[model samples]
Target: MKSYHLIKKKKNYNHKFLNTTFCDKDKIRQAFPFTALIGQTNMKLALILNVIDPRIGGVMSMGDRGTGKSTVVRSLVDLLPEIQVVNEDPFNSHPNNFDLMSQNVKELKKKGDKIYTNFIKTPMVDLPLGATEDRVCGTIDIEKALLDGTKAFEPGLLAKANRGILYVDEVNLLDDHLVDILLDSAAGGWNTVEREGVSIVHPARFILIGSGNPEEGELRPQLLDRFGMHVRIKTIKDPISRVKIVERRSQFDRFASNFLIEYQYLQDFLKNRIINARGSLKEIKIDYQYKVNIAELCSNLNIDGLRGDIVTNRAVKAFVALNSRKSVIDKDIFTVISLSLIHRLKKNPLESIDSNQNIIKTFKSIFGYS
Candidate 1:
């Protein structure tokens, strides 16, 4: 079934992005299949897990340049299931996500005329480095105020990205204050704008995705902990994998249309699988033993709070669903431990050990060598 909802607006909707002035039309409209990406096993896994369960929290992918970090992030757009939205809603607010609806939409509904609706690609709005505060959080509609003396709100990037991905490339360079606003919205699932005597609130729930070079700078610890999973990518060293990546890009450049046609089936298959997985997610089983295992693993790591434990459990479920499995097992926990707890681990610069290795050691100690 489609999730549908109502929205109130002054202007008749135009689906062409009123924002996203920075996006390339071709890049935003079409992308290489997620299945086609080469290497970066952990990075791919981290991305897919977030898609499966946004409640797992958002993903942070940090690495050196030329590791396909941005490519991997953009290609995810191709595989997302279509979302039902009120016709022309700048926010892409869901038809049934009434909690996020405007007060006007609520009042208009009392008349009992069914609100019109349509399905569209779930957006992935890029938070450009130079975007002004008004562009990010919206501002009072100056035209409305001047022409008609009407106080109205103009939806901005946060509104447009509702129920979608807010991707920040080179996120390390983003202003700390802007990052703080995103952190608040990602945590609480709403954005409230109070400016020019205009107060408008809308749901800002989205899967936050950020990629940056670690050498440039690290995210402040307060912000880093907000991300549920952190993944690092390395340049592909295997000659065969490198060759495959180059060949794929060459083929794409040489015959863009043909390349897309060749992968269309694979893309559709993945899309349908995700749709089905989402439908059946609540039915997918997680064992009581698995719950205990997640808790014990986090405990052994001395990770603060239950976010680590909760995110791990959600990631394991997503992994099972993505693999078409109905239930989770011990091996699932082992696969997710590093992704869940790597960033949460306290760094001991003097200890001279990899946090990832420590994650594995903990897994082995808890579950025994297999």
Candidate 2:
């Protein structure tokens, strides 16, 4: 068995073992398996739900350093189902969906040209902290357009991230303007760039994943609420669990090939679940009463906007689909309601109640939990 070493042998106990590099599908197999992660169940659940249904918007994870936040996100790459894209298209244009294809590809298809496509690993694009607006949103080359009599548009991170995941580490530290741009594109599923009075538009649909430490600086409530789900991750306090995590990391480091093989079955199982869930999402049903209860729960919590209710519904359905179920159950809502509604609550610095606990309490009151 061939080995895939993600980290150097030179030991730094405190360093993050997994590097969050965007690579080809073959290299993605070397990542730490998503199923092998030790803890942070909420974070994992949120990520999986988003994967099942990208319309759940995206997930924001805030936690302590070295809590495997980035590792978890990158590991998700291994489970991502490959997508068919037009050959040589920077936007990763979908083969059949005109809405997802670039303008040139659309014209080619309209002209009865055979649009060549190949299946490739779904993209996982990282937005660097130092990236400029043009780099992220792409730029239009006015000089080329003037000389060649064409719209010379350059694709950016958002273009590459179409039909994929866009992850930003330390997102709280990112520029507010850039953060606004990201959120806007995420919500609208399109990014439009204007340069020198020339404009270009492309599909920017992707699951926007952002992770950060709360201590660094919090995202403005308005911005945070835009994310469909928020998970709070804490460092593991249990001594035994900590030991298990360390042992697993050490084993993988020493015997990378064997470790991957050990978890190969679980990885495949998860990948298949994701693919099946996506295909069956339209078949999953949620009861009308559950929607009412969800609305009531959000109302009692004083969550701003209908986004909370909408995200909660989508997340619960995605959770059901992930379990290979045909309908939503009360317990399914319980599993995801907190993730969807907690961040939408109005900040009350004087309030002593924990946000998660508050949501749970409200849920029990409205939904009749013991």
Candidate 3:
């Protein structure tokens, strides 16, 4: 009966489609499929665009608890396309991109050595609340270096997260110092650990995704501004959508394998779409006028720095690429401008306007959104 229903439900669905089991039976319970996540479109777009172009910086998702922030972020483990990296490399070094390769791997490549490469799921690292700096930034074995004259360094979350995603839940509750460290590594694209004259530097580039409940606490504007995009997730209030979300979760919990099998097609389509977007992101062009409009939008909003303008441009390009379009359109700018600039606007406690509304109004006025 199950097989009959699976076959008859979607005419285009073929059992042989997607040979690889997207959700392994054993690990099926580990994460929910990304395609199955419903609502929270802004959060999903921000996350997807970051994957499409890591140079868009990272995403800051602030919303109510139980809004699927953590679940959606973790589900990215399955949604993301595989990345090719040097096999067994601690930093997840890219096979040919020297900028993303570790020094050791780069040296081996320079020596004309055969570098073994493997395709692995893009990593999604969870930064625990109680994690220490050393654990997050890696520690160097100074004693070993002093006695054996060899530098022995241990890689940390930042190293493992290279070329992947680093997710911090309840980010507002995390220590400010640690947040600073994360922002620094995220902005610089490299992490350096030094101990007693011993030092090691490695690529730490990753999509830094941080989520928190606004009711818990607000992140400092300085730290928040560093994020490339910010999205606010609200609990689903519509009766039908709420019921659908609940039913889907219950079905996923009860029939993990069948549920996964059912969603595999959508997952495959989204993963491939993301892969294509990444490939064509560089080809998606933005006109000079659009660039000026982006800058003008930021300027009119009184955004603190150029980061808003830069991120807005990058995000629009990613959105265009995600849709397989070669040129950004007015709708693309209208879609991405708020996510890229809303959090950067200076707070006006005395002002009556809502931040989101204010940004949208300014965007429509400047971009002629009508």
Query: Residue-wise lDDT of candidate 1 within 1-370, one digit each (tens)?
Result: 1222233232223333443422344543467678888888898888877887888888899998988899999999988878888776677766665775655555557667587889988889999988888888888876777688776888889888888889999989999999888878887888998756656788888899999999999999878888999998877788998899999988877766678778889888988878777776777778897788779989998888888988898888888888788988887878887888888887778977678888888788877774
What overall lDDT goes with each candidate model? 0.82, 0.91, 0.90
Badly placed stretches (over 4 Å) of model 3 are: 1-27
TM-score (C-alpha) between model 3 and the true structure: 0.92
Model 3 residue pairs with clashes: none
Residue 195, model 2: Cα distance from true site in angstroms = 1.1
Error of 2 at 2 (Å): 34
Ten residues in sequence with the least summed lDDT for candidate 3: 14-23
Give the alpha carbon lDDT tens digit for every residue of 1-370 in model 2.
Answer: 1232433333333243333322232343577888999988999999999999998999999999989999999989989999999999999999899889888899998999998999999999999999999999999999998889789888999999999999999999999999999999999989999877888999999999999999999999999999999999999999999999999988877776778889999999999999999999999888899999998998899887899999999999899999999988889999999999888988899999998889888888888876
Estimate the overall C-alpha local distance difference test score of candidate 1: 0.82
Which segments of candidate 2 are over 4 A away from where they belong? 1-29
For each candidate in turn, the TM-score is: 0.88, 0.92, 0.92
